[model samples]
Each structure stands twice: as structure tokens, then as C-alpha cells.
Target: MEPVLLALKFLVPLAYLATTAIYGRLFFAPEESRFARKATLGLAISLILHIALLLCLGYSLQRCPLGTIGEGLLFLAWILAVIHLLSEWLADTRRLGLFTLLPTTLCVVVGVFLLRPDFALPPQLQSSFLVFHIVASLASYACFSMASILAGLYLVLHAKLKHKNFDITFRKLPPLDKLDKLSANWSFLGSATMVVASVIGWVWVRKDGLAGMNFKELAIYLVLAVFLGAGISRRLFGWRGRRHAIAILIGFLLMLLTNMIGTHGFQN
Candidate 1:
């Protein structure tokens, strides 16, 4: 089972890479082309395989698969891919594939090749509440990641429009307004999830008598606050387009910074 799990871990990323190639064809193909359908189908299959791999890992370890940094990275990549597929289904947009899949593939590559998997599940994460909190937080991070990618695309389109560079790529991207709304929607979802995760984390910490107001916790809250502020500004001040995009980009940077400082269970 261990050997099978390891092989699946390697295979999952290759599947994702194949999906990326199929999606890349969408750049030249029509919106409703056969390639778009194939790409969507490929993503669905890849997601299923990824989930199965995680389940096998969990079963083999007799614990949650998210006990190690490498496992967490794989889980995060899975969440991103799932969320992207959901978004694609809801919006019927294939263009977001490249942006989303690029990071997804990178995450899988890093998880499989760069990070070492620790089979030991820490005592601190034995609680179900902590597990839920961590899962929710990772999901929120995935949402924020999608928002940042959309925001980046928004800025690129905005620049092209500003300079009147009506090239093929410019025409290929989603409309500025659509991208803005999508970014905002993802940000709102991420913020809401972050709030829930934070509350759960606080409660768990208090119940366990652990110090909850650490630097990493503070950083996570700060990032959540930025997302909330961005959403509020969008609603109250009617901030959109470039400014809103920049705010989301900044929030994503803060998220990366928080990850760099330390994640939940791994923090000092």
C-alpha cells in the first residue's frame, strides 16, 4: 500500500500536467470547442485520482493524510484544483484553467519531489476540531489563491486597455468587469471561511490552554482583516477594477507571508 501510494502521488501530478496541456489548447480553440470539453473532463478525472491517492495515504498511515508538510501541500493542491473546477463549471470559463493549473502543478511537483513526508502524526493535531480548522483554513487559502490569479489577470487586461493594446492575448482574457466580480466573489468566500477557521482555532486553543495569540495567529488574522477590508471597500466605496485587484494581490502576498512564518500545526 505504501508503494502504491507513492506511485499514485507521482502519477497524480502527471495527470494534472496532462490536464494543463489540454486546457492550454483552449487559448487557441473556441469557447465551446471539443478541447474545452476534454480539458474539463481531464480535470475531473485528475481530481478523482487525487482524492483516491489522499485516501490511500490516510488509510496507510491510520490517520489524516494532512499530518506532514508534503501531505498538506498535496491536499492544498487538490483543494485548488477542486475549487477551480467548480468555478469553471459555474462560470463556464476555460480561460482560468491555465492560471489555476500552473500553481496546482507546481504544488504537486514540490510536494512530491521537494518535501519529505513525515509519517508521524503530531499529538497536537489529534483533535478533530483542529483538523477541521486546518482543513477550512487551507480551503480558504485555495480561494484566496484563485482570487489572486483572477486579480492578476484583471490587472493585465486593465493595462492592455489603458494602452489600447488590442492584441490576440488581450482579447483572449476574460472581461475586466467579469474578472473583477469573480475576484471579489472568491475573496468574499475566502474571508468567510477564514473567519470560521479562526473562530474554531481560537476555541480549540482556549480549550487546550495553548497560547493562541502567537505571531503566526496574529499574521493569519491580519491577512483575514485585509480580505475583509477589501470586500468592504468594494461594497462601500465602490472600489473595483485596478484598485480592488491590487488589494486582493496584497492580501495574497500577506497570505504567503503567513505561510512562510509558519502554518497551524507546524508553528513554534
Candidate 2:
């Protein structure tokens, strides 16, 4: 059973990748069609496979999978996939599936590279706070990163419109106004979630009697500062354009660094 589940862990990602590619082509080919529908279905299948893998892991050895870097990545990927689908279900989301599912595919590929071809839960990584923290924070990061990239692309297009340069990619993207609103909304949600995740992790650490400020903690603080500061600038001073995009990208990268430090320094 574990073997079969492990095989599924491999097969599921491959299927999602194929779906993403096929649907991406159909999406951008002649006319914008039901790419979202196809990606959503693919994402749904991947979630089920992740659940099956979790069940197999629990059956063999009850573990939380929080202690390993490899498990952490795929778990984060699954969480982001869920967030992506839910966000679409709740609101108007278009053409972001490519970004979301591509990263997910890359994450699973990393998992495959680190695969041991078996399931055994880690003994030292059992914390509900950590689980929720990773899930919420990574999902937040996923959405923010997706939105930030789109914003940057929009800025590129805007620049082209100003008689600077013209390109094919910029010609096909959504309108600048649409990108602006979506980026603002996504950033707002992600910033809130990240703040919550950071607070939760701090509470858990303090409760566990391990209240030392680590690199990851510092990184989180810095990211929060940048994101919130940019938000303030956007509101108060009417800051926009490249500054907004840069701040978003900077915060996104710092969030990635924070996760890396968290996984490497504490878990590893």
C-alpha cells in the first residue's frame, strides 16, 4: 500500500504538469477558454493524491511531516494549491493558474528528487501550530508572489505603452487597471495571513520554552516591515508603479528566505 501511495505521489504531479501545459496552451492559443476549469480539475486530483499519501504515511507510522525539508515543500505546495482553488471559487481569478500550478509542479519535482520511496513519520515534528503556520504562511506567500509577478508584468506593459518598448508577452496580459486591483487585493490578504502565521509561530515557540529570536524570526519581521511599509506608502503617499512592484517582490523573496531559514536552521 505504501508503495502504491508512493507511486501516486509521483504520478499525481506528472498529471498536474501535463494538465497545466495542455490547458495553458489552450488558454493562450486562439481565445481564452476554460483553462481555469481544466486547471481546477487537475488541482483537485492532486489534492486527493496528497491525501492518500498522508493516509499511507499515517498508517505506517503516525508522523506530522514537519521535520523534513522535503516533506515541508510538498506539503506547502498542497496547501498553496488548495488556497489557489478556494480563491478562484470565491472570486474572479483568471490566468493565474499557470503560475500557481507551475510552482506546485516544481515543488513536487523537488519532493521526487528527495524521495526515499517510503513513508515514515518524523518523531520530532509534531506541532499543530507549526503545521497551521506553514500552511497559512506558504499559502499567503503563494498568492502574494503570484499577484506580485502579475503586477510586475503589468508595469512592464505599462512601460511599453509609454513608447519605451513593445513585446508579445506584454501585449496579451490583462489590463493595467485589472492588474492593479488584483495585486492590491492579493497583497492585502497575503500580508494579513503572514502576520497571523508569524504570530502563531511566535506563540508556539514561546510556549515550548524555546523563545530565542532566530534568523527566520528576524526575516519575518523584516518582511512584515517592508510589506506593511509599502502598503502605507501606497495609501498615504500615493506611491505606485515600479516602487510598488519592487516592494512586493522584495517581500516575497524575503518570505522565501524566511522559510528556508526556518526549515534549515530549526527543522533540519
Candidate 3:
């Protein structure tokens, strides 16, 4: 079991790197080129392997493998890959793969190398509500990450359009309007999921009689507040285009900081 787990730990990242390479080639090649098909196939295979790895880890540990930060990172990467693939298929855009896979690859690398392996499940996490809360939170994070990538791309393309700089890359990217809409959709989904997760977390806290807010809890609430403000600003102030995109980027950064503080701040 240990040998198989080790092998999967190595194979998963290699598969992602290969997918990244394929997508990189697709970025340079035409949209209808064979590389696009290969990139999709590569991503499918990588996602399958990643899911299998998670399943095997859960089987070996005799519980959900998301008990540790390392395992959570692995799950986070898996969710990101799944979301990216679905968005690409729905939008029929291959160019975004380059932007999306970069961060997924980074997550896998960090999970495998930087995080310590821990399989011991905490007592509080054994509950179904708690498990779903964490899953929803992580899934929401994945959506926000994707939205951030789309927002970043939107800013780049918007700037290119403003400067009348029409390069091959610019031509390959989705239209600014499409990018903006996609980013907004992702942000909406993320915020909705976060709200549901927050409700579940509150219920769990009340049931368990946990103490006052911890650093992680405070950070999460702050992220939720940011999302709420962004939503309100967009609807009431008519903040669209670059303004909306910048809001998404800021929200994603805050989410990242929340994750960092959650993972490291409470360790001591």
C-alpha cells in the first residue's frame, strides 16, 4: 500500500505536468489543431489519476483523506482540475487551459513537497456536516481561483484592445465580453457555495458549542464579506468589465491568504 501510494504521489504530478505541456502546445497551435484534442485527453487522464489517488488514500487511511492540509491541497487541486475541464468544455475555449493549469500544477507541487503527510482525522471533522462544510468551502475556493484566472485574462485582453495590440495570443483568447461573463458566473457560484458552507459551519459550531472565532474562521468570514461586497457593488454601482475583474482578483488573493493563515497560523 505504501509503495502504491508513493507511486501515485509521483504519477499524479507527472500527469499534470504532461497535461500542462500539452496545453502549452495547444496555446501556440491553432484552436482546431490536434494538440487541442491531445491536451483535453491529457487533462482527462490527469484528473482520473488524481481522483484515483484520492480514493486510494482514503481507502488506506480508513477515512476521508482530507484531514490534513496536505490532503486538503490534493483535494483542492482535484477540484480545480475538474472545474477547469468542465468550463473549457462548456465554453469551447482551449486557450484558457494555459492560465488555469498553471495554478493547478502549482497546487499539486506544493501538496507533494511542501506539506507534511498527515492522515489522522480530527474528532470534530468526523461529522457529516463538517465534512460537507469543508468540501463546499474548498470547492468554493476552486471556483474563485478559476474566476481569478478568467479575470486576469480579461484584464490582459482589455488592455490589449485599448492599445490596439492584436497579437496571435490576443486573437486566440476569448472575447472580453465572454471572459467577463464567465468570470462573473464563476464568482457568483463561488459566493453562493461559500454562503451555504458558512451556514453549515455556523450550525456545526452551535451544535458543538465551540468557543469564540479562531483566526481561520475570522479569515473565512472576511472572505465571505468581501464576496458580498463585490456582489453588491456589481449590482448597485454597475461595476463591470475591468472593475469587476479587479474585484475578483482581490477576492481570490484574500481567499489565498485565508487558506495560508488557516494552514499555518494555528499550528503553534
* C-alpha lDDT of all candidate models, in order: 0.85, 0.69, 0.83
**Model 3 misplaced stretches (Cα beyond 4 Å):** 30-32, 114-118, 263-268
lDDT of 3 by residue, 161-222 (tens): 99999897788889999998898888888989999888887887777765546878788878
In candidate 3 the C-alpha lDDT for residue 199 amounts to 89
Residue 168 displacement in candidate 2 (angstroms): 5.3
Model 2 TM-score (2 dp): 0.83
lDDT for 123 in candidate 1 is 67
Full ranking by TM-score: 1, 3, 2
Clashes of 1: 0
Candidate 2 root-mean-square deviation in Å:
3.2
Per-residue accuracy of model 2 over 1-268 as CA lDDT, tens digit each? 7778668777767876886785476446655565656666777877888777656654554555544566666776776677667756764544556666777778777865665535553433356676778766776777677667657766777788887555654555667777676677778877888888878877777666553676667787898788788788989998776677778878888877877664423442
Which residue runs of candidate 1 sit more than 4 Å off their true CA positions?
Answer: 28-32, 114-118, 264-268
TM-scores of the candidates are 0.94, 0.83, 0.93
How much is 162 displaced in model 1, in angstroms? 1.1
**Which lDDT value does model 3 have at 52?**
84
Consecutive 10-residue window with the lowest summed lDDT within model 3: 259-268
Worst 10 residues of 2 by lDDT: 116-125
